[model samples]
Structures are given as C-alpha cells and as structure tokens.
Target: MTKTKKPEFRPNDFVVYPAHGVGKILSIEEQVIAGMSLELFVISFEKDKMTLRVPTNRATEIGMRSLSSPDVVMKALETLKGKARVKRAMWSRRAQEYEQKINSGDLMAIAEVVRDLHRADDQREQSYSERQLYEAALERLTREVAAVSGVDEAGAQKKVDEVLVGRAA
Candidate 1:
C-alpha cells in the first residue's frame, strides 16, 4: 500500500516560510529528482531575488503558511508593546533560544523577541550578542510586517518602533 500526497499550496498564495517570513507562490511544477518526480511550489520574495521551492504536500507540516489576517497582524503588533522578559541565565543559552525563535518564522515569536529585546529611552546598553539578536529579530519582524502592510521595510520598522514608544510613553 502507498500513501497519497495532498496538495495544500496553490499558485499566487502568500506563505510565511520559517526564516524568510513572507513570500508569494510563483508556480507549482513537477520536477525530477534522482529518478523520482515530485510536485513543488516555487515561491518568490520581491525584496530578494531568491526563490524557494517547497514540497506541495508538506508545506503545512514544515510550518510554511499564509500571512496572518489583519486582526492577527494587529494582535502581533500589540504584543510587541508588552513587557520584556529577560531570563536570568547565561548569555550563550539565551542567545541560542532567541536564535531558534527567530528562525521559526512565526510573526508572534519574532514579535516576542523584538519586544523583549527592545531598548527604551532609559534602558542600559545591550551587549554585542544581545544587540545582534535584537537586530535579527527586528529585521525578521519588519520584513513580514512590510509585506503585510504594503510598506517598505524601513517604514515598517519605524511603525513598530512608534508603537512600542507610544506604549512606553
């Protein structure tokens, strides 16, 4: 007996791939790989010329998904303005976990990291690794936000900072 594959990805669909948040499906094509033919979705990111091919049936299982709705995006933004949780642990350990969450490509997770690592007007300076992690989280979140909001990445970053500052003020 053989298992059948179900197709969940469609052309022109917007999907958030872990690590590269938001991209649009360019096409679905059959490709031969080592004497086996398989169907894959070709996704393209406008900001970058890179194209990603994902297995049609495993898109969801692998955490590839469409962008959250407006309400979802708003909720994620609101989450960014909340309290920051800094664990009292070694920097190496914390850095590893933060890296994993950023690579997860989930908007909420990215937002959590951004919120937690965000520096305010009165806060002390962050360490080199901390700054690196914060920048990575912010970059990942802004890219997704920009794609969803139809704004540029820098503009989206400013929008996020504005929201955080508004809450802080």
Candidate 2:
C-alpha cells in the first residue's frame, strides 16, 4: 500500500483546532501503537495551558487549520463592524447556535457571535448566559486575530473593541 503524505503543519506554526482556539505546533512525533506507526502533531495552547496531540492523518478531517490569511482576517474584522442580528428565538436555542459558531473555528462565524452578543453602554445588559457566550466567542476570535495580524492578544482585543465602538456610534 502506498503511504499518503502527512499534513503540512510544522513546529512553531499557529493553528486553530475547532473546539480550541489558537495553539502553536510544538513538535511532530512518530510512535508505534498497535504495531502501526503513527505520526502526531503536538500542539500547545498558551491560553488554556494545555497540550494536545492530533494524529497527522486526522488533522484536516478534524478541522485543524493554519491561521487565516490577512484578507480573511480583515473580512472577519469587517464582520464585527456589521450590525448584530439577534434572533427572536428562545435563549437556549440561540445559545446552542452561538456555541456551535464559536467551536467551528471559522473566524467570521465567531465574529458574528461576538457582534450579536455585544452590548453597548446604552443598550440593555446581556443575560448571564449571553455574557458567557459572548466572552467565549470574543476569546476565540481575538486569539485568531492576534495570530494572523502578528499582534499580541491584548492588541487584537483592543482592535475588536475599537471596531465595536465605531459600529455603536
């Protein structure tokens, strides 16, 4: 049988794992398990202080991806500037949808959640659950924005806040 090539991610590269936010590739290791050789990508998440090992073959299937391009990052930031589109559905349903978007590792979807859940100074405060989801989405989006834009996390957050402020004005 011909062996397939492994995924192209390398050490020191920033990647997004759908359920997690941004992580840096720590190393690639080969191991023998069940008498079969397996290649794994060891990733470290600074925010969570967690390390994860993903099989090379499963990286793409599991939605592990490189940082978004500058163009895509810009688009996501633009998404933040758009008006929020909160639905009239029940809170539970909206929360579920928001959770999915945040975990999908799609920058724009996370931005949408952040935009919809963000409350301006003049607007009504968000419910506890709303605030939780908003913070989760914001964290995910900001991490990616930081990685793609080559800025620190705080700077990325400030940029997002600036965009939201402009939108609110």
Candidate 3:
C-alpha cells in the first residue's frame, strides 16, 4: 500500500481550530506515550489565552487548518449580505444548529449565523442567549478575517458591519 504524506504546518503559522478561533503555532513537539512516539502541534490562542496540543496525525481529522484565503473570505462576506433565513423551528433547536455551524470552522456557515442573528440599531434587541451566540460567532469570524486581511479585530469588525449594514439598507 502506498503511504499518504501528512500535511506540513510550520511554527509561527496562523491556524484555525474549529472549536476555537485563530491561533499561532508555537512549536511542534514529540513525546513517547505507551511506547509510541507521537508528534504534536502546540498552538496558542491569544484572545482566549489558551494553548492547544493537537496530534500531528489527527490535525486534518480534527479540522485544524491554515487561515482562509482571500477568495474564501470574500465569499463569507457575501454570505453575510444574503437574506437571513430564520427557521420556524424552536429557539433551542435553532440555537443548537447555529452553534454547530459556528464550530464547524466553515467561514460561510459562520457568516450565515452572524447574518441571521444580527440586529440593526432600530430593530428589536436579541435575547440573552441569542446575543451570546451572535457574539461568539461574530468573534470567531472576525478573528479569522482579521488575521487573513492583516487587520486588527476592530477593523475586521468594521468590514463585516459594512456588509451587513449595506445589505440591510
């Protein structure tokens, strides 16, 4: 059988972990466990102040990946400009689905959640849980956008807001 080559990611490279947002690779380490040598990627999330150790072999399986490309980011922003589709389902059910989408590490899916939950200044306010979910998804999307665009979080947020507001107008 032929062997498949493992994906190579280097130290100081920015990566996205599905459950988390953008993080930088601090180092790659190897350790012996149960008589087996395992390699790991040591990633640090500055916003959350958390470090994650992911097995090198399982990175793809776990959806760990490099930052989204400019084209992908443009598509995600386009997704934000689309009309919101709030299902008639119960809030709890919808919330769970939104959470799943945000955690899926797909830029478009996260954009959908942000679009659906976004409220204009004059619109009715979001419920506490709804607000929480909106912020979480927004944060995730913005963090990646910021990294990919070489902008600060606030600047990325403004770019996202411009799209959302333009769509609403």
Q: Name the top TM-score candidate.
A: 2
lDDT of every predicted structure (CA atoms): 0.84, 0.92, 0.92
**Model 2: per-residue Cα lDDT over 29-110, one tens digit each:** 9988899988899999998999999999999999999999999989988998888998999999999999999999999899
Candidate 2 wrongly placed segments (more than 4 Å): none
Model 1 lDDT, residue 27, Cα:
99
TM-score versus the correct structure, for each prediction: 0.87, 0.95, 0.94
Query: What would the per-residue lDDT of candidate 1 be over residues 1-169, giving only the tens digit for each residue?
Result: 2375665668887788887777899999989999988788999987778898887877878889777777777988999878888899988998998999998987888888989888887889998998999988888788778878888888988898888887753
Show where candidate 1 strays beyond 4 Å.
1-5
Candidate 3 residues lying further than 4 Å off, grouped into runs, are 1-4
Better of 1 and 2 by lDDT: 2
Score candidate 1 by TM-score against the native. 0.87
The lowest-lDDT stretch of 10 consecutive residues in candidate 2 is 1-10
TM-score-wise, the better of 2 and 3 is 2
